[model samples]
Target: MKRDPDFPLVRNLVITLFATNGHLIDMGNRLVRPAGLTTAWWQVMGALGYAPAPLTVAQIARNMGLTRQGVQRVVDLLAARGYVALEPNPHHQRARLVALTAHGRAALEAAEGAAAAVDQRIIERIGTERLATALAVLGEMRDLILEELAQSATPSNDPTLSIENEE
Candidate 1:
């Protein structure tokens, strides 16, 4: 396959993104540890906290770009700890809506507080404009990747969509 001229740069970007994700998750785990929450648990709780209403496991998974099974496991653990409550979904009979309890809100707030200093430090070092630009670029890249994923998942007659073609 003839590689794109920017392939190397794109490869480096992807590698950096993967490494950064790992580092961020590690940092999040450390920050949230005092609240008795792992990074995964914190993420799930954050999703619930940000939502306008309680969400089903499947809905949370979709919003977080996670597998439903994985979110289900986290939700189960959260519920067992009394951090979250699962109520019947009005729309779906089986998929229960997961809502953060008062305890869960406190835990999430603690995690956010712990991370606030780190976030401020990062912003101070990186500058708000640069961070904003980076965020926009990352959002664009994510959208493009999602488009590719959706296209690949669907049956297509277009030859350009073949694996042998350059991305």
Candidate 2:
């Protein structure tokens, strides 16, 4: 079989990225689960660790680029496991804020050691310096492209006008 040169290259790129990320998460989860954690848990922990301030589901979702419901489920599980605490949101009385509990902090600390092991393995598999540079470049490009797409997709001042991708 022959393939067209312009055969939806973007689709192939998206699939490759997702598959690689899923495998990486699998490795992380392997390291975390033994310490009573999941890949989802790490996402929340990383966000809170990045900024200790309590964040609402919506806020964390935006920051993590995940759906609000997706984060809510993770928060619910974390709370049930006593790894996280649910607090009233000061900014929005109706919204609940998610914060890491003492247990969560301890768990995260333990997980960090495991994370280092995973990091070392990955670095050895893929050159440490090369992977670091590739990750930075990919992140920057993803952000820039998303920003451009968002801007272009926004409705124009004129009614009944909006830019979009056409097949």
Candidate 3:
């Protein structure tokens, strides 16, 4: 079968995006580590902090585009450390609401300050305009990818989706 002429360009873009994501995650981990947070922990905490009210583990997972079990693990860890508190959910009997405690809020604020410093450094190196353009392009790419996924009938585990052709 003949491949689309644009396939190579798309493939290269995907590879670059993956590499960039890794670098960004590494930077995030470094920035938040001093605050006693990993990138995943920071992300979950940020989501809860920004929300109007507390959220269940499943709700936080959905907001962060992660698995419930993954979010649950982090929530449990945070709870154990007194960074977050689990409250009885009026809406659900089993799923408790998770809220940031004073300690969690303080940690998140510290992490945000550290992140802001990193952002300033990056902005100085890249310029705000270029960074804005890059963000816009990334958002467009994400939307296009979502659209493609919505339209695609191919099974996620299909061998044809693999980088290397399978026999």
Candidate whose lDDT is highest = 1
- Model 3 clash pairs are none
Tens digits of per-residue lDDT for model 3 on 1-167?
99999899888989998898799889989999999999888998999999999999978976676777798899999999998999999977787899999999999999999999878888999999999998898889878876785578355655444533211
After superposition, which runs of candidate 3 have C-alpha atoms over 4 Å from their true positions?
1-4, 143-167
Model 2, 52-124: lDDT tens digits are 6988877787788887779889989989999889898766766678889899988888788888976777799
- Clashes in model 1: which pairs? none
Model 2, stretches more than 4 Å misplaced? 1-13, 124-128, 152-167
lDDT of each: 0.89, 0.80, 0.86
Worst 10 residues of 1 by lDDT: 158-167
Query: How far is 8's C-alpha from truth in model 3 (Å)?
Result: 3.2
Residue 133's lDDT within candidate 2 is 91
